[model samples]
Target: MNFNQFKEKYQKFEVEEFPNKVTYSPLVSVLVQTYNHENYIRECLDSILYQKTDFDFEILLGEDYSTDTTREICKDYAEKNPENIRLFLHHPDNKIIINGVSTGNFNAFYNFYKAQGKYIAFCEGDDRWRDPFKLQKHINSFKTNFRLVMNYHSYITVDHNSNLFQTYQMKLQPIGNISGTQLLEGKFHPLLSTTCFKKVFNEIPLEMTQVMNVDTFLISLLGNFGDAIYLKNIFPSAYRIHKGGMWSLKEKKQKYLSKILTFTKLEEFYLSQGNKRLSQFYRDKKANTFKMAAVFYFLNLNFFQFIQNVWNYIKTKFFNLKFL
Candidate 1:
């Protein structure tokens, strides 16, 4: 369809047949947002299709107009498995305007907002669950808990040739007890795809979506209501690490600087947004974020590293450097 036609469709999507029929389904909604993930979409969808949950669930594939054949494959899958898959396919015109730059995150929100299930889970096109019980585990937690958010750890940050570089896990001890103060002080969110929780955001500010860290706003809202559970299971959906991935940008020096400055400013904003003081946990969390930003700043900067070495030598000469 043409761009204008898609725009008209999106404007009316809320009152369409799917919206009206959503309340009839009594189960979780798995929201999958796709751009051009032709290579990985099958494996991703296969994982979801095999979920061992007793309850019913639907897959909402929010597709952006992909330049590749990804949309065709999704269409084929939906047509073949009409019961399990429902495509809220985006028309080309439904593009999001981010600082006038339209990208896939626009479609992410569109699909996310049109969710009809009582609970929601996220799975990006490039990622897939490693375990069959991924959905069932989260669904059980959600059925028993009234908390606004729940997430599990995923295997990310792999080595060359696609192997685990390091096993990663977040501090999940205080799972069901996270407070806004804890979040402000630095309780963090796990991977987006690894999370599944109740639909808690009813009044998200429009501006929050435009910022690069929309997930932060989402988790913040959840943390505001109740504690988010951390499933601690290491074998969650795999977040592929490749050249096309966000963290794999070749312009590390420039990207690092920009992200660091943005996050530092965000940290400050988080502290002051509601006239709030961060909890000790969150304070340490923000501090760690800053430290990561500092390391990332000089990660690929030869000159910056040289200058830093020189500075360290000078400080050592004066016996002024302290590792406190």
Candidate 2:
């Protein structure tokens, strides 16, 4: 559904809007989802606010009832920069639970629904954009190619102590586009924090709401619309690796389980979409992940879990069984 329809259906939650001073509509909406990110929220907001873009962009900050001072900080930023920031305070009860794990899906969905831009960019509260012209560069690429539905750049990883860990540069030469088929075949996967895509939420699948890794599903879904561009030369954004970070700090088993669930649902989703090849791709990925999980369990001396995962892998790979 469109933004208006989405808002009409889930308008029960309250939102605090800090109106922009500019009369022109925003060309890009930067979505920032945060929870207990008090330490990094300031830098995140500042990085976006510092962007040197000619076109107007609005920051849609979704603060998910942070237990720390994150909410206060977000409110302060919204009030001070009314022209750029629109903070949405979320309640704890509104969080979406997947497999008994609470997620920021509700917060993210609300921000997306309220976004008033042709293109939507994403950067979590813990990550910060390093390039001053990041948005301008991506917008330029989109404007030059009408078929491009998504664009992403390289990024650097920083450790919890704020030291540089690694740099992930795109290997594509001369900065070219990759088709949706390539994306589905695992030729390229973009970092969510470095991605900017066209706003087309009219056909968001029901499986998207059921999965925990919404970002991965979203990138895959965007590929269905058009090709994606890779920026090879832009200054890399910073992806923080902190102890409290969502994906960074997860245990290996937990990460494996999440991936398995995501792949299972994606396989079913593609099958329902009438893409048997893509469905099988995810099915194979799910089996591989299950095998890896079994190995991990064996290495950890968890015989029971190891046997369970091995059985699951056998069923998935040999019998074409589904987990969901």
Candidate 3:
């Protein structure tokens, strides 16, 4: 649907009625962090604004000095809808190069800290929900259990062009508990945008170390504190796939391969963070990662030039898998 259709459908959503109480659930703070998603930001913000939940909610839109008209569009929305929209413009005091690094974890941490809600939720600029009751579904789940993270599956990979693939439940653990080791073993949640958390976000310590892939580290910390519930009903948010996405397995094969190396290095440094069995599992997977990297690297390498390095590494380390 077009932007007008989306907005009209959103405005048509039925609002749920609520009973008066002395105290109420913490306002649901939805953080809509955008960098340069001028194409789909409206759909994202509209989805949140159109939620049929009875609980009060606010949006913290952290627009990171987008060069495109993303800032203008967001500002326009905030102006007419002043009560629910909180716009944070990321204007640097000292001029700096505007790389894709503007929407770092610090941006999320800072906005989340400023949120005056009891519960927190997130939606990316390039994604939107299909169901108007998405927030209400998660909020109702919290009433039954005050867990750290309340998650639901999403039908990702659909976009303006086509759907390359569909992910039903992107999270590694769907039925039971998930461990940090499972995350390292190539098992992980699809995107941080798939889940929402309690307003207990401030308790998380944000520092220099949390500059990248901070959501993984943050999820681990949250898992330590409480359980993460997963809803299984079939509604899913649309995740637009393009060059702008942080991690696209199809678009960034080389980058993804390098991440395997990073994961292995992290596993070694934080070895004590998980059990020995899980560490060993990742160690085995690390071997496969290296082998795949070698295969891809060798395919593009000069004949017999990098062959020596590849052969020596495989012979010296992965002797057992050599027969393959």
Q: What is the TM-score of each candidate against the true structure?
A: 0.68, 0.88, 0.67
**lDDT of candidates 1 onward, in order:** 0.60, 0.81, 0.59
Q: Encode model 2's per-residue lDDT on 158-259: one tens digit a residue.
A: 865667864333233224567977666655667788888999664456677677888778878887788898887679888887434333323776788788
- As for candidate 2, its clashing pairs are none
- Residue-level lDDT of model 1, residues 6-60, one tens digit each, is 3454443432122222334747889888878898888889989888888888888
For candidate 1, the clash count comes to: 4
Off by over 4 Å in 3: 1-26, 92-103, 146-148, 161-186, 199-211, 243-254, 257-288, 302-324
Candidate order by decreasing lDDT: 2, 1, 3
Please identify model 1 stretches exceeding 4 Å from their true place: 1-23, 97-102, 156-180, 184-186, 243-250, 253-324
Looking at candidate 3, the ten consecutive residues that score lowest on lDDT are 14-23
RMSD of each: 8.1, 3.4, 10.9
TM-score of model number 1: 0.68
Q: Pick the lDDT winner.
A: 2
How well is each residue in 166-214 modelled by candidate 3, as lDDT tens digits?
4443434354444534433435554667677765445443221323555
TM-score of model 3 (CA atoms) = 0.67
Q: Could you give the candidate ranking by TM-score, starting with the highest?
A: 2, 1, 3
